[model samples]
Target: MRTTGGQLFMLVVINAALLAVGAMISGGTYLSPFNLQSMAGQLPEIGFLAIGVMLAMCAGNGGIDLSGIALANLSGVASAIIVGSFLSSTDNETAFSIAFIAVALLTGLIGGTFNGLLISRLNITPILCTLGTQMLFTGIAVVLSDGRAVAVGSPELLSQIGNGLFLGVPISFLIFVSAAGLIAALLKFTPFGLWLMLMGTNPKAATFAGFPKARVLIATYATSGLLAGLAGVIIAARNVNVKWDYGTSYLLIAILIAVMAGVRPEGGYGRVICVVMATIALQLMSSLLNFGGLSNFVRDFAWGALLLTFLAVGRYNLVGLLTPNKSRKLV
Candidate 1:
């Protein structure tokens, strides 16, 4: 498990290819400050979901997060409805904001919790369990909205937080950094992180080693759900209205980011930094494409291509990524 620059180089190549194609589709320009800023704003929610999914994707554990999009849409709609119904424009803003955060966080937590329970206790396949939840969340959202979008008030406040800049940095970017830092500390410094990954890589051995497999699996799913909820809230905050399919578009990209972020679908291998960098690269690539006037769909295809390529690399061990390295990657 040695990490090497060559392995990292593969990631770079993937990124460069994505950037080049995105630019081509976008019609030329591939770099822009505004686009970077926009990507910064967009990444947090996507990053959150991607990271959430990554935690549970432990290899040999046969787990994956296919329901994040559905969970996000459901949790977001739930947040808006709960907050909007309870607090009017006339109510105290302080209480309203607190309530908003709580409701949103709780909705996501519950979705995640349910996912964990089903996978751990019921012994359902992660894919099947999450698929069920995904359907449940999406269906609930549609039913709640009656196929209509519910508009929220005081978008200015939400915008201020969602679209805010602090010390010339996007608040959302700062949040992603902070979140990654916290998780990195846990993963690199704490035993729990190691154990959780251990569960993913070799569940039979993990059980032999006395790890609580079910709890670990459940917790990972729960954490993923929580992050998805956070992303849901952020996206909902950005939109003036909450719709049933709010996160439908992000589902595929989230999976792409999770894979590119270095989460081995086999379960036990991946990095948050992988998620962050891959996501950033995509963000940058898409921006470059837009600036160049490339068709959005074409830029999207670039991403699809990137996913296909890396997946091949992963499966075939074609690149040096699967090899041991001289220098170890930082935790």
Candidate 2:
């Protein structure tokens, strides 16, 4: 088994423990089919953002995408204005749906391209670039909507995508799973993935070996932007409106999920499977807390505490300390 498998196992154990305790406290309401399905429906939005965070972390260099939720909001706002102008959701459902999705994705791609150009070509630091872009995206969104939420009206097809189920699984969750699978394959089987990992692991070695750093960075960030766009679509689908300030806490939560998945901050190594498990683990924990009648503020505090604990463990190599290597031959 790979290192990811061990990490995944730990996450699974955490998830199970949370579920068991939740069930005990909630008198099995937590384990009911309805609650499980609700959890599945809730997973995709954050999962998509977390994947984008994972990609940036995998690229190293203090890499992170603070702009993901901002860009996602921008994408949704732009889509609503553009799609709503030409087509009525009630009278031209098909055309409106097609145009809505296209505009959302295109907006996301363009925003992502902007980030890639600044970071890859201009040599801006990833964190700084994304932070600036996050504000820029939010500004654009606020100006476009005049700081108010733009309502999408929950069109039939959009609602189905957001809340519908097929074969006893939420469609949004399936979409999340599909996206995760594609990313896993991209990282495992493709030359770009190899170059990316190598670049993150040892930038000097990759540069010396003639790797195309610009192309890799551009593609990686663009892909991250695409994911953000998809997340925007889902967010709009689930909610009746899109606003600049919506999901204000999402950026931090996404980063938390990536870190919990053990994505290295200095770059080089991350696993999509581990990220998937980490996401599920988090959702379970959040649900468990909710079942326990905890307020959202408490939940946020708990998430922050957990994030700090994990970061400290990683920083101090606590796993190494707890499970000393027996292969040292007594030093």
Candidate 3:
């Protein structure tokens, strides 16, 4: 249930080495602790996507939302429109923020609920269900944006929250941490959480075990959508605009992070924290690559190599990396 120390140490060392390499490649600017903080900022949003997809995956060996990126984009558009529809230009930031959260949460729930029905009740395959939803969500986003961008204006506080630093940590990083903390708590402490893992590793066994399989399926998806929507809001808050294609690239990147984080694509074996760490590592790598003068192709190549290495390491090596004090024995 908890990560061990040696694995933790290995992860630290690996990330430290990567950080050093990234900083060295960037020369001076990327070496700063502040730069590290900036890179950390990128992890959370991507982390959200990874975790959201991971939850659905927990119920089956291969459950995932390939359209998660589309969900993220759709949420962003939804948030922008919500603000546009309800929020005021005057100055009451509190009301606007509340409205934004409510809209974001509800919209995400609806999307997730739909996907859950397709998979859980209708018995559609996860891959097919998500693919269909991905297109549907993306279309919804396009329609919301009128095939253009939804720009945020006069939301000064939003830019502050998105870009501001809280005690040297970016606000976006804080949001992710807060969100992750909550999710971790629920998964660790709730019956629903345990059921998810059970369902994933052996759905038939779980059914035989008499777990409320359908409820679990539906709940996981709904949670995923809610989180994805929140990520959208965060992105919108950061960029000060909701771009039609903002989160489109994140779908594959998220899946990559999930795999590297040691979450078994086969389901029922992963940790929220691992995904967060992998995401941080990935983002730092990305930032360093950008500053280090590597071409996008080279960066992508390195990412692929890293992913393969991570996969080869598998869950046990990664767990050993993240939690060394516990079982040295690989799963």
Best by lDDT: 2
- Clash counts for the predictions, in order: 14, 1, 14
Query: Which digits, one per residue and each the tens of the lDDT, describe model 2 over residues 184-222?
Result: 999999999998888888888988999999899888889
Q: Which ten residues in a row have the lowest lDDT in candidate 3?
A: 1-10
lDDT of 2: 0.86
Q: Model 1, 97: alpha-carbon shift in Å?
A: 2.3
Q: For model 3, how does the per-residue alpha-carbon lDDT over 232-324 read when each residue is reduced to its tens digit?
A: 767777776776688555887888887776677788867777667777778877886777677988976786787787777764465555555
Query: How does candidate 1 score on lDDT?
Result: 0.74
| Least accurate 10 contiguous residues by lDDT in model 2 | 322-331
**For candidate 2, what is the TM-score?**
0.95
- 190-301, model 1: which lDDT tens digit per residue? 7778888787777889989998777777777777887877777677666666778775658778888877765778777777777778778767766666666779789778
The predicted structure with the larger TM-score, 1 or 3, is 3
Question: Considering TM-score, which of the candidate structures 2 and 3 is the better prediction for this target?
Answer: 2
Q: What is the lDDT of residue 76 in candidate 2?
A: 96
- What TM-score do all the candidates reach, one by one? 0.88, 0.95, 0.89
